[model samples]
Target: MTDHLILRPSGEFAGPVDEHTLVLGIETSCDETAAALVLGGYDVASSVVSTQVDIHAQYGGVVPEIASRAHLDMLNPIIARAIVEAGVPDSRIDAIACTIGPGLIGALLVGVSAAKSLALAWDVPFIGVHHHEAHLYAAFLEDPTLEFPLVVLLVSGGHTMLIEMQDHGRYKLLGRTIDDAAGEAFDKVARFLGLGYPGGPAIDREAVHGNPEAIHFPRAMMHEGLDVSFSGLKTSVMNHVRKHPDVSSEDVAASFQAAVVDVLVTKARRAAQQVGAKGLVLAGGVAANSLLREQFLDACVVDGIHGFLPSREMCTDNAAMIAAAGWHRLRSDGPTSLDCGAFPNLKIPGLT
Candidate 1:
């Protein structure tokens, strides 16, 4: 994995894209501190991610203050490792990219500030990447030449939504969760079930040996258009557990996982068909869930649409996706102003 850029005119830059310039990416969106060097938009030279699971696991979930301070310590070293692993000096990096929005404010700043400092030092363009937008772009890293007009299902710890990508940086928000995000619900349900921290993985593992049909979990808002709601289902899980003291944790987990997966795949597929999409891309942290991934891909095949999924590592938050998205943004819109600051609630571009 070599990081080399050909200094050529724009007219002369057209050709195979596997040998593209190197972009440094930083991500501190939540509990993960990550950095990477990506070639072009799709070729990943090196990606480094530091997960804060052990620190937050004792607390049930991520604590904002702890998350930020951790990022401050982890960000720089991770960046250095990625640069070293990619076999490139900081001076040779062509651009810098960082997740700048829709994440913990303090955590987001750790990455954005580092990017600005690096850009100034290296004299490279600074690109700010939207967190959710980058999740969608993870699919491109797996295969950059994928057909457009694909619907992306981004299901993370804090967010879950269906977006139609008409093209790069252009999107149509089809639907979103009305209350708790899928991953959030997973955490809550898992905690109540004594399944432990980071619910998605916990529930996924337990549900494997359990019977999904053992319990009749409610699938909320199934016929109510594309928008989804998991709050009701979560409540139902709590109520059931409270009422049935002897309830099997595995059964509850399997049933709960089934409900969430059913809603997600159904809504995503319907949204794709509504927009005449050519493919369906499952992304974000929750995309790493076993059931959701299996059902999503099966649904896409049944519907006759291609399915695109990043590796489990890429499915979760990582700088490689941010770097990949940043590379495209740098090429399409030039550099973002260095004065731009972190936006914890920054909306995805082209959405109301």
Candidate 2:
């Protein structure tokens, strides 16, 4: 548990919340039950995540009912640990932030209910955060000086999209997945290859020792504007495995990973060039992929664009980024009413 606690204090709090203004962030948007104490917006006092990987591993993916139940059981302890680890009293927190959408509604409700209750009990504001928006804010958590006019590639198990961020709270959707997301495709292909659950890491580890070009996997959406298609690529992998019963899993994994990386890099770079973006930011679970990270950095260098990525810990679902984004929203727009509800398809406003 201690190993999962990423407590990095950024010296001092500087954003909307200061040392005196602390914010508690709760995130139960998915299989992870997370809580964080953030001073100001970027300064993380303590961040704790109770992952349901073990529970969901057998099922090959997250079961919404199981995930929600686990969150119900783990959220209180996680939140308590975060506050205790941060050395702050409940009364010290000025606001409570919770992920409110673009995720499993049952899981989201647990966090939102807790956050609203905490806010009411503590007499503080309650802020509802967009899950994907919070992922974008993760980049800012590590790099406070990172600027806007950037392109953000949000790739995760559930989402894949290229967003043009001109300023805070402003976004333009450039492209998205027509069917399966990149990470989802990775998981499905890994399952077809007889790899274990949570395929990203497993495939990544195996790909390290295999030949990426041994099997030529198709790269989707090379010329289809910014939007990508991964369903065909996944089907291709499945077909290859079925036809070549004796094919090496390592080679397939490497080839598949390479295909995904190639398409992601091409589209991301295209989006950046189209918008004349000064920086490129990658966020979400798939952003933690080693190959993706290396390839993204290489592309940024080739294009003379700055690249921003959060620490591996921040790349996944965590509440610190939610708090960071929420702090800004709280200061700028005030708190959300208790009537606000969770939204599974909550789209980030201003995106087309």
Candidate 3:
């Protein structure tokens, strides 16, 4: 269990092997128990996500203990299903990968433990993937031909940061949230607005029918470099609701979303321009936001920079992205040590 395997001279493991590589990726980072089969980094044979959204919806957020237990219960079956759907024999898997950090501790352990065990059983290399880094890799899975010099904005419930990608596995963080991340702000505000759990989708749907200019919510740090702030905006929304009890919820939602999108897009574009990036990318869970996606693309057009975003499935937490990142890691850095431990607060490389 203490041995670290290298994939450089590997026959079937991830690398520039004679044939394509197959990786089984497991992810139990939060409320989703996911497993996937990815071929040659970009081709997804099958991906299965058993979401606990309904179970966590009652609480308006994920409970780490509950998420961990659910992962333990569902992971085996999910992995099995991915293999079955991919029509690949268990022994044919070239490598095993799993998200190892920057998530709920217990939730991360399930995936890590499973991945380690599978690698041992299958006698293949194990790759421990960083959660946020994998999100950036999701864009590559959709289009493997993406060029370097990319300005990537990673926005999610737990993190918000802008990174400059010089190349695969090379990143330099430009800025990040000083307080609450964009997703956390969305969840808190959505709860205050009685929009139910998983606030991003709730607020997005409501905003569709409402006027984005109805409230003119504050856009924090619009001119303050690439770092973002949303706590003030969240508080403002709550205070507004208290004062104007009769205010339209749809209007509130629209106004709040507009504030977020404006800040993210403006900052992202600025970063891209500063770095002279060839492409701009939106990643992480919150990138799935409709307004963010639409506005981001529109801004990219205006800025004359190439834009990249993965499908909604890849935007949120998933094992497929983990596998895709894993393949790249194995190819470039070889394999991870078996003694590697799960890190709940694993920051991406070049974290500011």
Q: Against the true structure, whose lDDT is highest?
A: 3
Error of 3 at 102 (Å): 1.1
Q: Tens digits of per-residue lDDT for model 2 on 1-352?
A: 1211111222223335444568899999999999998887889999999899999999999999999999999999999999999997787888888998879999999999999899789777788888888888888888888777989999999999999989887899999999999889989987888788898898999899989999998887697799999999999988998899898999999999999999999999999999999899999999999999999999999989999867889989999999988876666556777666788878785465
Using all chains and alpha carbons, the TM-scores for the candidates as numbered come to: 0.94, 0.94, 0.94
Q: lDDT per residue, candidate 1, 1-352, as tens digits?
A: 1111111122322323235678899999899999999998888999999999999999999999999999999887899999999997777788888998888999998899999899889877788888898898899888777898999999989998999999887898999999999999999999998889999999999999999999999898998889999999999999998899898999999999999999999999899999999889999999999998889889988888888877999898899999998887777666777777888878786554
In Å, residue 303's CA in model 3 sits off its true spot by 1.1
Report lDDT (CA) for all predictions.
0.87, 0.87, 0.88
Candidate 2 lDDT for residue 180: 96
Model 2's alpha-carbon lDDT is 0.87
Give me the displacement of residue 287 in model 1, in angstroms.
0.6
Weakest 10 consecutive residues of candidate 2 by summed lDDT: 1-10
lDDT of 2 at 334: 65
State in Å the error of residue 72, model 2.
0.8
